[model samples]
Target chain A: MNIPLNITKTIHDWLFSIMPEGVATVTEWVIVAAAYLALFAVAGLYLVLLERKVAAWFQLRLGPNRVGPWGIFQTMADALKLVSKELTSNANIDKFLYNLAPYFVILSSLIAIGVFPFSRQFQALDINIGIFFLFAVSSIGVIGILLAGWSSNNKFAMIGAMRSGLQTISYELSVGLSMLTMVLLTGSLQLSEIIEVQRTGGWLILQGHIPAIIAFMIFMIAGTAETNRAPFDLVEAESELGAGFHTEYSGMKFAYFFLAEFINMFIIASIAVVLFFGGWLSPFGITDDITWFPETIWFVIKVLGIIFLMMWFRWTFPRLRVDQLLTLEWKYLLPINLVNLVLMAIIIWLNWTI
Target chain B: MSYFSDIYNGIKTLLTGMSVTGGYFIRARKGSITQQYPDNRETLKMFDRFRGEVVMPHNENNEHYCTGCQACEIACPNGSIEIVWDRQVDPETGKKKKMIDKHIYHLGMCTMCSLCVEACPTDAIVWAQNYENSVYDRKYLTKVLNQPGSKVKAGIED
Candidate 1:
């Protein structure tokens, strides 16, 4: 069933009624931005805690249990510690670019969070070019990483930044092509429209059959690489580069880079949710009759599932060597992605989509 | 065909790896092998042969088997054991005999080699199972093993 409540729209109309149009719109923008900032900050912290706990379980160890029940407050305490720490850096660093780098990384993820259709009528920016906008903003984050590396005046950081640039550029093609393959089935780049199409035609993974599944596999791999996660984490290869590009960053500045990574992972997982799994659309409409169970919950559940899957990849696979990383992208993922895109187009053309 | 087969085998191995971790995750609550140290102190038991520290055993009458022979003192590699002795008249036998004034043990220098325990012909010293041996003062590590006013067991041969 469709979302019964339009809480965001109701609040918008109420604000416009009491104030002038310009004032109301600006006020609404401020509120939405503030809300998204809070949402992502908390989500990033908990995702870190979740990663530690999941890793512990996989290794058959008890994770953080010292803080508030089951170590819920461990990340909170860590964030506090990071905040109070002194912001130390090398004296030889470029002041302008060094200061600007973290904002570039964090703001891009926050902006991308705005376009997601959390539930019906709950989207902040329902732009027609939603998928393109996400891709554009996500690519901007690598510029931040590059700048952080270059400005730090450290060789290890510089090497990490270079690796990040190479990895992201290679993976972006597969990420785009895989999404493009799914776009062939839905015929729209707008995320809300994509979900709406899935609502009527069943999930794209089932409808488009083998090609869709192939696209999904490629998308997950590319998406993980895009976020600079493990197995593809040559960017900050702890063993080789010693924390990669942000080695010189300390205190809250380092935290900004750390938080941005988790938020980027969320964004990638959200995109996967919107495309492959039906975004906010219940499976077979089982819970459609229960109006109290919101569509937003369903959207969150799917996003978290994809995030967990990514985490599983992180803890399971070993990091790829620099050359192997390149070979995998160019020889393996890219070729498969291109053929899958063509296959999806043919499936749609011949009315063979399930 | 080999290229596709390589990809197939790679994915297969990866899945096998995931299954192993996933199985551990499923049984995580019971499978965790972490020993919460201080919390489990009541239940913690060291093996019988664990050489934690050296102790001189005393019987109910506060009498020990040591004849003040100083074999353990010579056998100790690091000079961890020292025995002070003086000749005294045996009350029952009315003859002069060697007796220990103090049996000093320096826990700090002891290497836990069990050599001193083995050198004792009378089996006076044995290894204690208590591993928590830390003390705030270095002086506390220098222990006097013999009790105050305690004597050697009657009829013990040197």
Candidate 2:
């Protein structure tokens, strides 16, 4: 692992030459962020169109197919329409906090994009504590959601934000803990190191022990809740709370929140890949040997697979009630994760590495 | 007792709860659920009373009963209706009569409440089954019910 500084200098020179000049770090982050924003736009488009299509299939009706080919551009058109609309904030709430909340949530979500190992050595910041940094950074959006609810001066947005705050905070405990178990076993906080561990020892999903299995499940479920997607989607329970925290927000600010949700979805899915499934690691590490397929392809495949599974979950079930949501969290997820951590320690002691 | 009670109780409840989500996760539909609307619009069926858009009826004699009555225009709540009026002198009576000219309705503005059809006394305008009303410009929406220069039937003046 002793790489020469000359090589490192060469890479630094190469990256500087290739990437845009002036605030290179910020520029790289901007690229990373813009890439994710574009992805959010695409995913939101797919998600909306797919949600409509899925709903139609569930109800035995045709969905939006008149916009583009198979209504592919329908979500785009809807987005354009929404953006053209007048953004209105009606209440006399704390205007500063009301406005800043969405930006904060959105900022936190976009910040999480940097930590993803899109390919080997192809991340925004190869920060040492990338994994923990991600969990810490991503969780700040909860504060934004809560502040949005509180600042709106509306009872429903506040309650939704409060529920989102508590729910995400509680689940994030397990997400962090599950990851702590990985850092403990792998002995590194870096995402690349975690991937290296999985690369050598196989993905944590196949880590052939009770603790790994338990941790993976906790991360997946908690991650889903973290994104405020369906089943755990009580934050903006449309039937009850009228579009949740950003109910009063409109136009591009609302678009930011909307885009952030999808970005957060990708972020959580990437974490799940890096921590559990395997970041850019292919089946039996077959693609690991192939020279043509860069490590990023494997990463995208695994990430997309997880995203697809989430989308499948989103369209399949009805929204869970708030009590059901808490029960699922406080009652079910937290305890299993705790036990799973304990079980993982025992497995590591037994040297039962998969 | 209280030490293990917190998370231990949570575990008992979570296992109880996950069985539900796990069950749902397993029991989800095993097929794609996307519907291509325009591609299959020709085959798509509409409900019995699905009000789409308004169209004037064309008879075997090529005569439309719309007698220049402005009830539909007045009745529309969204201002979606606009009637093109052409004055014609009747050959039989040698008198100028306002004939039901041309109709230009913006389907984009149409709420599909069937108020226009209800307001028309001559039963001229009826709801058409055509729901695919995607248009680029706002101008192409108006429909001319009667052929230009086609004489309005002899004494039909409402």
Best by TM-score: 1
Docking class of 1: medium
**Where is model 1 more than 4 Å wrong at Cα?**
A1-10, A17-19, B40-157
Where is the poorest 10-residue window by lDDT in model 1 chain A?
A1-10
Best by lDDT: 1
Candidate 2 lDDT over B1-158, as tens digits, reads: 66468657856765666455545445334433333345567687777677877887766677777787789999999988888787878777788878766777787788899988988887878887777787898677765656664545544553
Error of 1 at A69 (Å): 1.4
Write down the DockQ of candidate 1: 0.60
Could you give candidate 2's per-residue lDDT for residues A1-354 as a string of tens digits? 112234444656776887677666666556656866776568666755765665555444566767777778887887898889887887588988888888898889777786777777566677899988998999999888899899888989988998898888788888898888777688889888888888778787777466777777678778888999986889999999999998888887888788788778888888888888878778787865556666777787787778866766675556887787787777677777777777778878888876
Clashing pairs in 2: A331-B14, A332-B14, B68-B100
Per-residue lDDT of A160-185 in model 1, one digit per residue for the tens?
Answer: 99999999999999999999999889
